[model samples]
Target chain A: MAKTPLDEIRSSQVWRSIFRHGYPDTERNRTLAALSNIFLHLHPVRVRKSGLGVRYTWCMGGLTFFLFLVETITGILLMFYYRPTGDAAYNDIAALRDHVPLGVMRELHRWGAHAMVVSVWLHMFRVFLTGSYKPPREFNWCVGVILLVLTLLLSFTGYLLPWDQLAIWAITVGSNMARATPFLGHEGPGASALSVHGLPLIHSSDDARFGLLAGPLVGEGALLRFYVLHCILIPFVASILMAVHFWRVRKDGGISGPM
Target chain B: MLSLLLAEGHGGGLIPAPVRSAIDRLCDPQYFLPLFFVAFVAGLVFYRKWTQPKVAGGIALAALAGFGLALTNHNFLEIVERPDNIPIVGMLGLVAFFTWYSLRLAAVNDERIEKGEGPIEKTGSNDRVLVWPDLVFSEFIALILCTVLLVVWAIAVKAPLEDPANPFKTPNPSKAPWYFLGLQEMLVYYDPWLAGVVLPGLIIVGLCAAPYIDFNPKGNGYYTFKERRFAISAFLFGFLNLWVVMVLIGTFLRGPNWNVFGPFEKWDVHKVVVLNNVNLSEGFWIGWLKTGFPAWFGASPANGSLAQAGNVIARELPGLVLVLLYLAVPPPVLASTVMKGFYKRMGFIRFNLLVFLMLSMMCLPIKMILRWTLNLKYLVAMPEWFLNI
Candidate 1:
């Protein structure tokens, strides 16, 4: 048989270097294809037949991670047209919506975020109902719990990016809760008890809420602070935690099944 | 026929005025919350029959149809159509579907176990599949579908952006993000300290502690409600009843000034219900006992004397004592009675931790009842120290 151009490319050194395996038709090549690829390696070379059912797993966890990627891509595009300042934030979003081409990236990011939250909750629920958190998986469950909290915090911080009435007020109501953080908050339970020599230590300007918002109220400072958290800080932390979560899934003997 | 029924006007839809009004009344948090909770529990209790494939599908279809019918009502349509609130609508559908799906699987597994067979998952455990095509291909397809769905959703519904940030004019009934709405609703019954900070903190800790606390080895790695009934029921109660239901209430039912509105009711800016709330101290000292507050209890902190602190504590003596008893007494009593198995399995420290968390979870509902029944504001209110619970 004459060698086709496709076969020639496949036999080429550059192609060979990039893809260590040929077409994953045979069993050995199939295993090599998965084992050699970085992304595909996240899954084991083989899985239990029961674990492959969409009904058995719901695939909510994968959907959540996929949504996170959607958010990240659209979010990066949005950042090109956005500013976190109180002055420009709203106009930037307006511009993105009304002017920029395919600017509905904002909508995608926002909706994807909402979807991610729902998916994460469903993922946790599925894990719980299946007793996937039992015994050896306990520590990973703790890590997953933390990841859930991070996801919420990511969404919460992102809520303030638009700097609209809905954004500010919702954040105001949320961050206001920090003002009542036990002894750390100015108006909390033991605030008065934390006084020294008849002088109170914690106050409005230097309390847990102040630290969160970078000011007494959710204003410019808060907008900037939340922007950093939403864009950089929380995502950074979440990615690391996610790595641990996925690693432990494999380490703890792949997708769980009845023994 | 559908269009005729859905014709909109002053009466909203084909639903008669009296029926709509009755629904409006039923939607009140006082009535709605408990009913939602009871229905959820009943569904779980009767999971076997209800989770049959045909029955579950029928119920799900009926629910969707009813929801479709509700959207014909102008007010309901307005609330549900808001782009930000749309996911919540989607969530209701998704949650219902998953609940049915998971329960159906559990039902199947339970039946198999009863018939001297293994769980469905166990049946094909030895049969392995290749990750290269089987898993990876499915994942790639899922990724493509998800992307297409998101892109279509983005184009169809514009993301919500109201007027720019204005510090002077706060929105009436300002709400937290959808997920935190459960905590926000809790704020109605408890102090921000408890509702916002402490409870959320405890929830994370409790979730993390669940695996350690639960000693059941029967239901490991499979869906079997019969074997893990208590654990499954408790989690559903927390997730569906406490969390998701509260989010739904906050998104749809809560209106201007944080008042509950019916699905068909207008979100009237001027709508007001009598608050007339009183704290426990006032209720104890003046309302019930008909006596004056202790003078030193309200003493100015200008002196900042230790004696004033003592008086403040003394003033809240009744509330303080009751709260102490509530926290301190439950473990031993529960260990000896209802949770005897739990205590035995979890042992001293784990058992106490479990009970403590459970009791803390109960506090939210208990406080909610007190608020509804007595118009009680706080169990322990100390303005001088800015302490309340």
Candidate 2:
């Protein structure tokens, strides 16, 4: 019988040749070999290398990725029921929690976001403690740091999407807070008559907020902007960076061991 | 406070009525059954890949089946509806049981390994548990404590879901969470752009880049403050100084309308006097320039009736000193000390860089403090010539 593409991909001799390792005799070895395969490349490679245990570092980076995956899955599931319009966004979120078939997705996404921030910080802390950022791994550390910021940005941008009171005010206060950046600050240089070539880009109290929200405070445009950023833009950027982060870890000779 | 507690009791516990309903709804069998089944399946999969794989997997599967049966028979729904505090009690009991079970499991596993009969075969080449026992124990304790505290807090003080957030009725003090108080506090001191965007951006960037910045491998497993004493001290000093300045500004300097606790309510006299007395143009420019002074001289500007002027001087001085120190101190110090002392002291380069980074971090607090001392009204009142970006 002829095989399907997925079946062929799964059972192809070339796939088996490249991926399957060991004698393939023992159950344990077979499991390990399967995990090590290119098809299952998402999992870390098996090695006898050791320094500190999972207890010390708690696999924070991996756990953070796990939480991110959880968020993405749940977030996408949420979009199925959620409407991003001003009139419906808040009500939709409420309905997801109060009326939808699987409302736990919302709570999971919310809690997962908080957990991701924590796990990412701990990951960075663990990396710091292990002195993993030294020499050859310095660039990777920088990339990891940028990933951290993107994670926070993802959370901050997403905070407004639900259109709840907490979401609304938090973003308002957050954006209001953004108005204090030097050039971007509302009271800063470009915010006043003080300008270059007489172009008043940010020349009023509302300018910074206006630019951020794409208008005066959180409105329809702001909702859509935040929705795009949260679901599509930031996550896409984060995933690409995360891929680099993981690949660099391999390039940097795996996780740094204790001195 | 006691009266408030009594009043709250009369109103029906700390948990708001709506939130209680939400909790009740969450505890329903419809919610629990699906969640439990999912967790059971996941746990089974994970267990299957590890020690006693088949047995653990079987038990998890059986548990899931039992739960499903109960759900179908309406038995679980009856248990949920009974409301004899059984759910809470059961959860607590489950937590206690799990704690005991895990400890026993660990002991048994350790005994097995010690007896030369390992609990599970080392299947994968990388399957060796990399986690240190001490770290594991510490984490376990921490997790247990955090869980207990969170559960207790949730039960004790039910957080009232605030009236679904209304945008138009902006609160008098529309602040972020307490963690962000340090930053929000800065809005009182610095330009909103600096407070809101640049400073926070720097801090986040700094935190992210921390592993890269302090790249010495000599201090693994040691606390940062203990191993890299000077660098850590400098960083802490910078963090605390900025935090203090911001908090002070948030607490005292914000206008009367925004004052949450009014200890310095009468101190509006100072604002009135400054508003009435100081020449806006001369003071503003002089103030702006003074921000650059304490860097030249090691001494900070004095505080009191001249606090506004002193603050201006104090804030700018540190920044100026920091810039000069970065440019001048390192190369000269390196040349005189490390270069002269040893031929192969590439380590000194790292040390100097670390010091420079720490010093730069200190500048954040300096900038924050200066901005705080300047107060919001001044920034609002200042003409373009006096304002420095």
Candidate 3:
């Protein structure tokens, strides 16, 4: 048989060096293909046919991860134009909408965020309904729950980026909750009891809300803090947890089914 | 609230007045919540019957058709078409459809199991397929499809950006993001400490603790509603009724001043409902008893002394005792009665933890009912310490 151009390329030194497996036409090569690639290695060489069905899993978990990737890419593009400051943040968003080319980046990020929340929730629903969270997978379920929360926090922090009435009030409403963080919050139930020498330890300037906002209210400092959390801190934590979650999924027997 | 709306005007224009008023009455939170609970309970109870594919599909079609018809109305259209609220509308459909789909699958599998057959998922051959073409390719396709869907969505609906934030000019009925709207709705019934801090905290904690607390060995890696009825029902109640229903209420129904508006009702700024909330202490020591409160109840604790704090505690003793009884009584009674099996299965510590969380979850509904019926604001109102439940 004549060696096609694809075959010739596959046989090339650099191509061979890059890809440990040939074209995954044959069964052996297919297994090698999944096992060899860094990304594909996340999955086993072969998967149970039942687990692959869209009906069983709803593909929500994978879609959630994909949405995260979409958010990350679009978010990076947005960072180029955005200035997370009280003076410039809102203007930057306006610029993205009016001035910047393919301003759809901002829209994509926002919509992708909303989609991720819905997808993660649906993913949790699927897992619970299938009893995938039972037994040996319990720890991973906890990890998944934490990831779910981190997902919300990411969306919450990002909500402040536009710095509009919608952004500010929504965040204000959310952060107001911090003001009631038990002893940590000035206005919480046990906050009044936390005092030294009859001087209140929990106050407007020093409570959990203060710590969250880095001020008495959501101001420029909070904008900066949320920027970091949305772009850096929470994502960093979520990524680490996601890694653990995926790793455990593989480790604790991939794609649970009848034993 | 419904009467107020009705008395204001005959609901003329657009859809028929009778239909509009009927919807308005139903969407009132008092009726809405109980009706939602009934629907949820009915869904779970009749899962086997209704989750027959034909019936489930018919229901989904009817629901969508009804929703589509409702969108023809100006007032309902205005609310659902808001760019931010768009996702919530999608959420309503998606959650409903998926819930039905899942229950249908469970019904099929449960029937199969009863007939001494493996679940549909397990009935298929135990054959495995290559990940390269089968799994990876499908995942890549899903990725592409999601990308296309997201891009189309983004193009179709511009992300909402209201006026530049003004600290002085708060938006009427200021709301949290769509997902946290449930928690915001909770603030109506709870003190900020509980609604804002503790309840959210407990939700996460409870979710994390579920797998551990659930000791049942049946239904693992399978769908069987009959075997895991309690667990499934409890979870659905929390997720659908408590969380999603609240989100829906907050998004579509809540209007200016955090008042309820029917789907077909206009959001008038002037619309007002009296909310002269009274505490349990006041109901006990003042209203019902027809006597003045304890001496220190109304007195300011200026000294911040132990003696002063004692006076405040003494003043709130009625509320304090009632709250203490509420918290302390339920677990033992539940363990001995309705939840005897769960108590025996979960053991002392796990059972108590389960009961504690369950009661905590139940608190929102109980408090809401109290507020609705008696205009009761707080069970224990102690503003001196910023503590109220």
Candidate 4:
């Protein structure tokens, strides 16, 4: 009524159109505020204040999500320079590190990858420690474990992109582990154990690692395949799992508080 | 347009020699970080004792001040020469935050209790804060703080880039990434099939299946280790003793050709420790009978039952018994005694699942100890293709 600055902005046409609600100061507006916003969709209209305790969650889940977002951004920028080829990939990484504008993007992405893994682990640990994964939240916890595995895969695949000695050998060590993966591996259980008329089930030609690398070993083909898995495949799967994870968190009555 | 990446500033400050040297030592990530981590863990125990949050805050502030000062005057170039500095700083920061948070949580609980209330403060949706402004503001604050920290770190320490991909020119200690260092350490005590493949699969499966199997409703939605002693102790043992210990060993103690070098030991390229790995069959024949393989069982000519006899009765007989005893003895013992309550509470299927998980989890440490003391590689190492496990 006095035509104050606060009243002026709230009454403005542009503000009204964009926000749909002014200052979420009332109950109706608070509900509307959560409902109207796109990003806020992840949240319930309210949370138990007990769940808001820093020690309860340790901010691990939030930090993991933040790191993922950082990785997404820095990764997209990296894609602008990276070429998923044996010849060009290593050189591209070197160029990105040395010559590119805001070359620290590479470093950010690298460090972000490491941070995401650690945070995801801690998040799981927090969930377990609190017994938050009990009962109705069991499915969400399983989803979280899947997401954890996906995170590891993402890191493993991304490891080869640098195409350095560290990258190559690490991938070699990691990929070799697949050979002992039960039936899917050439040397794993049930591979040689199951012989239908002297024909082994899984052979060197059709093992999990062979399928992963697209060749006998970690080479150019492996690098290209890993690039696709890292960039396109794993992230997409992780995102879907994460969506369900967050949805379940809300559906299961938000974060676990005092029982 | 090249964004000017600022040259890292790591100048010597106006601090005195002795104090600076002490600060330097206290901040020497290798020593300080581990000690700080242990201190933080101990602090967490005390923190739950309903301490004043202000004390925690004061300590955090002191740590931050000291750490910040160290960062300002510290020789980043020298420290940055090692790739581990990122984790060092990140870990220290997290520990500091954790200490403060733990004490704060204790204080909050104390306050709640003093108000003639329970641990839970449940309010209806009417008392809720708006997700848009209230929640988003805090999240954005966290995100922005993280972004700034990451940016500063990225600018300060350039990501490590080793030589180009060369399969022929392997590193002296061709290490996996830090995350997989635990597995790498396992490779020391186990066959690749076991350590790199089987154990990892089992761990993942066990973790995924944990919540479903675990039906102890005692510690749900609370942080009391007393209520969830088994869960807490098991998790802490696996985490701190197994995973963290292995990773540290892999990262620090493991040197050229994967020898056990001490923290202060220089990694000599030629330092080789000869290890004789014996398969189950070999161990049986050579270890027990003191005879060669083919002649041990008196089966030379190519026959099926003879091979089976050699396998079941000859070589694998004692080993199989030992393995069976190892797996079976623990469950009935646990069921009758210490974990009898868990066995009763978790029911048949879930109880069996839990026991299986626990036994397998116990195997890692048992195997590790055997490796350390007795130089035992695998319990039943056949090395016969898929039957290795």
Candidate 5:
């Protein structure tokens, strides 16, 4: 039996160096080293020596990450079939529901979207409850909160990608609501001034929805903008933040436990 | 409603006819050509760093070549769709191959670093711990479950593209989605600016800022009751009260046609006319003082339908109750033995204020809900009233 390329790759000195750290040198020592390493800091430092089983901190953050990964995979697949044109978008979605060979991708993306929101909220609640956001971790907590907002933004942007009546009206109402913000609101001071004076300022009420959708209301341009945002822009930002978020946990001395 | 009177006469643009298919639109080289080039460049950079760390600069040069290729290929779609071309699949294979190779190369560099003789330096902290088995196994389990769920969902339902949008025909009850129904529900009770903007903005901003605002680090991994028991209890109570108010208003306050004013509604013409005639100073002085009487009030003249049911139950009762509630409840409650007990226990003055503010803000929604459920006729009778606006 000869070793396959994958096996050889796995056994290669480079693979061993990057993945395993120094060899365990020995099995027990390897196990101890694993327990002590910062990269694997998420694991419990010590198993219970007693007859009682290991105590697991509810890993809500890990679950949220898992859901996120699932979303990314499903989202990319959905992109293959989804067309972000105003005319075809709604029809395309309906077609996927009624006719596409693997229509379940749409449902998974939808349900996963809903589930991800729920999980992210729970993760935040869990962290709050655990006092994980205290002191040195406060900055990370802020980052996590931004990540949550981005998660929500991802959902909002993706919701419009389908370009159905539901998506249109929802975004309309949502953007209209955005227009009502005190300073930046469409009918607010800047907006009123813009309408009265015909200023080309970015903050003009006329430009509010246009700024967001990259064009007038939920039209062809809006759909393309949302598609890029949902698929490419937001996901890229979130992935980078997520990597920082994970690295920060190790830097912040792992998750908080009972005092 | 006053807002109806104030609304500009202009109508919004009609929804346009559906345009071309998304695939046709997106497939244009102008849209995706740059994207492909960027991805290729990124892949090359990653691949070179991972596989041949020593010659990683070569990958950058290769990326530049791919960028040039993408730039030159204007008819990418034609090439992709051609019978013999199979460009899309080829591109996918190329990306995957590069990614895999990069991973392998990176692994080898890591191994060399481990032996303490490679050009790639290992930080001392890298020696700390390496518990991949447990982490990897758990991750694998989670990944498998997620995959199964995805498969099940994909198998169960098919989502189709819909007919191109037709903007001309506005659907009746053009409401927002279910999540936003909660806010849409609020619009019926409050002013559009308040309902559509301020409240939702405040909630989201407040939610994002929760960690900073509630800096108490005393209790973690405990129920709300267990950690900062007073704050949590107050928050829950306030949340429940607000929820109840929202539900009541959403269900009962809004009219069938979403009208703030209707034929049967009482017009608030008197107030409007008075406000229009009298300057703000005079109106404010007379309105607020209960001393400087207006000429009409002084004369006590009866003025048609306005005078006919001047003291109708719907017209006067809610305002009376609201004034009384606002004036009466808080002081008595604040003076109560229970609140005193709470104040004594929660030593922080800000906590006391927060509790009071939470309870007080809950009243706006409550008052609005009450007016909606009980005073629809009054609202209808009132012609473009200030409150409605």
Candidate 6:
């Protein structure tokens, strides 16, 4: 029998290699379809019908991850224009906001950061309320928590990048709090205490606050440090933790369902 | 007295407290954590563990606590900046609670069997849908909808930008980002180390360790508030009541000098309250220790020696007892009563760990109350080292 163009392509080696299976008409091929593709493999071959219910899992975690991807793309685009310096930081943002083409990318990134924090929080809330953070899925929950903290850190560090009145003072207020971190801060409790010598182990210059801001205040050094943290360090750590989080979700028997 | 509660900053005089000053009211569970123990006891009686499961009792207790705290002040329903945000925040919280409540009534968990291989072991019928079309299609739609939302939001509200970073000219209020405003609010009530570093660190650590520390195995892979009532309730209290409340207070109530403003009051830059933010040591030394910190312990109590420290301690003995009771008492009580099953389930090691974390978590509310009620800035105030609470 003479095959049509569709059938011909389906039978051809090119299509066979690309798809690695038939049109997924049958159940066997459907499972294979998910198993064979890297992207599809992220999802299980077959998730329970119950697990698919939005009523149960609010789809918050997935939404958060999606927002993260949006942020990554928009943030990268923003990095090209952003100069995270003391003098030019605010000016650069103004330029990006006002003059740059597709300047809405900055807005998207900004809003996305806000949305991501919100979504991540909701995701955690959803998980906790549902008791999805139980045994067999315990460590994954820890990863999720770390991811939450990382998300907040990312938002905070990115906040300073704007270097405007809000950014400058907010970071100052936020970072200044660090100087009073009990054992870690120079001004904190036990920072001055020693068994033998009266010489304090940590002083104003040698505390967590000092390390965070290279000097005593939020100046040039702090701006540069925050930029690097906002751009590079936090995102790097977050992505790694996120990767672990997703992997663990799959490893710990996919998403939870009615037991 | 009314004028003090009505003082410029952080609250509306409309929401009256059952005391002389609203802050001085012996309420606001964030400070008076001992109140939680009362609620827990009442919940235990209300639930009667034999007949009921975990759901209704916890919610009732939550409601009770809410009702109690509302007696102090609830600006949640009050208007602040605009009308939209109030309904949004209100609905957001209400919807989640109702969803859980409705799900309980539905008995959604009972219809299903345990998972083995996949959910619904040996149903024999193929209830599973194909992933490629079914899952991907839904996700794609979600992606589109979310992107539209983000775009619309971006268009509607232009992300705010102010003058360039100026160290010299601090803003009038000099606020942190809206998110950290809660911590900033805490700073008004607590020492910087407690508000800024320790508390934040504790929250993170507690959250991360929650799953591992909790030993219950009933509500795995399912949504049942009944089986895990106490755990879920504690979380709702902390997350919604404490953290969310702090965020709200930080955002709306606080004004210049971090003084609380009434909801109806205009944020006039000139608005000022004559505040006497006296530390405990200063309060103790000047107020109580009329002569000097009993110099018997060491030379010159006022000379910043250990004797001076002892004087501060002796003066603030009531605060010390309250602090001790707030932190030390919850665990043994929980283990004996309401949280007994969990205590036994977790054993000594895990139980104590959870208790430590729980107590620390409880301290946030307790400290907050103390601030409001007594203007008690620190449970353990050490002025020289900048460590309070």
The candidate scoring highest on lDDT is 1
* CAPRI quality band, candidate 4: medium
Models ranked on DockQ: 1, 3, 6, 4, 2, 5
Interface RMSD of 6: 3.1
lDDT tens readout by residue for model 2, B1-389: 33243333343334345654554454332343245445534432343233243555575577566444333322223322222222232333333233233323334434555676543212132444322222234445655554464345334432222345467876545545322555776554455555667667667566555655564445443222223433333333333345433443343333334443221122232233232322222344456555322333334444332454444445444343544666567655665765543213435654455455555455454543343344323322333422432
Question: What does the lDDT read for residue A159 in candidate 1?
Answer: 94
In angstroms, the error of model 2 at A230 is: 0.5
Worst 10 residues of 4 chain A by lDDT: A47-56
True contacts kept of each: 0.89, 0.28, 0.83, 0.60, 0.31, 0.72
Per-residue CA lDDT of model 4 for A135-165, tens digit only, reads 8788888899899989988998999899999
TM-score of chain A, model number 4: 0.92
Candidate 4, backbone clash total: 0
Question: What TM-score does chain A of each model score against the native chain A?
Answer: 0.98, 0.82, 0.97, 0.92, 0.77, 0.90
DockQ, every prediction = 0.85, 0.25, 0.79, 0.51, 0.14, 0.55
Model 2 spans with C-alpha error above 4 angstroms: A1-40, A100-102, A184-186, A190-201, A204-209, B1-166, B177-180, B204-217, B220-227, B231-360, B363-389
True contacts kept of 5: 0.31
- lDDT string for model 4 (B1-389, tens) is 01112224424533445776564445322444356457645754665552465665676678677645544443432332365445634643553354355335445644555585534433231254556566667778878888898888788768877888987887878778777888988776666677888788888888888888877776577555545656766766566556765665676556789876543334678987788755555666778778755445446546564565564444555666787888788777888899788888877778777888888887776765555456665556555555553
Each candidate's lDDT (Cα)? Answer: 0.89, 0.53, 0.88, 0.72, 0.51, 0.70
> By TM-score, is 1 or 3 better?
1
lDDT at position A245, candidate 5? 90
| Stretches of model 6 off by over 4 angstroms after superposition | A1-18, A194-196, B1-127, B274-292, B298-326, B333-342
Error of 6 at A157 (Å): 0.8
TM-scores vs. true structure, each candidate: 0.97, 0.58, 0.96, 0.83, 0.56, 0.80
Chain B TM-score of candidate number 5:
0.39
Worst ten in a row by lDDT for model 6 chain A: A191-200
List runs of model 5 lying over 4 Å from the truth: A1-58, A81-83, A87-99, A188-207, B1-136, B160-163, B212-217, B234-364, B372-389
By summed lDDT, the worst window of 10 consecutive residues in model 6 chain B runs over: B113-122
